[model samples]
Target: MASANVVDNSDHSRFDLLVDDKPAGLVAYSRRGDNIELVHTEVDPAYEGHGYGSLLARSALDAARAEGLRVWPLCPFIQSFLKQHPEYLDLVPQTQVTRFKLA
Candidate 1:
């Protein structure tokens, strides 16, 4: 099994995914009041098809939950992830539910 880890690099406003201690992917975000706006997601081509994107998304969303913050998925990857993972639907504010089509 590959050794993988996710870390929140607040200084850079992104959650990084490391595999075998090497950078594999990242989820960029911006904090807005009580919400976190997911801006972009990128996984190295070498790491593609390894589920690193999903891992990054989950880690970012999990962090938001722990911090009691909502999510605004501006990134297409995050938006698709949210649609497939309804368990995280609560993280999106009610006001943005329709806008992001989370509901």
Candidate 2:
């Protein structure tokens, strides 16, 4: 199994996924006050079907949790992810939970 690692590249507003030290995927986001708006998630075609996308999403959300920030899942992928992973629901702000249908 390949070693997977996730790194936050705040300079580019994205969290990168490295599979065995190679670029595999990324989660793009924007910091809004105390919230992090997930804008998009992409995995390299060659790296697809290997669970890299989920890794990216999990890492990004974990970062938000560590930073004490809220999550605004603007990307369709993130919206779906959040719905499936209700354990992270608390990271979503109460005011916007209904908008994202996570309530």
User: Cα RMSD to native, each candidate?
Assistant: 0.9, 1.1
lDDT tens digits, residue span 19-88, model 2? 8999888999999889899999999999899888888999999999999999999888888888889999
True-vs-predicted CA distance for residue 27, candidate 2, Å = 0.4
TM-scores across all candidates? 0.95, 0.93
Q: Tens-digit lDDT track for model 1 on 31-60? A: 989989999999999989989999999999
lDDT scores of the candidates, listed in order: 0.92, 0.91
Q: After aligning candidate 1 to the native by TM-score, how far in Å is the CA of 15 from where it should be?
A: 0.3
For residue 81, model 1's alpha carbon misses the true position, in angstroms, by 0.5
In terms of lDDT, the poorest run of 10 residues in model 1 is: 94-103
| Number of backbone collisions per candidate | 0, 0
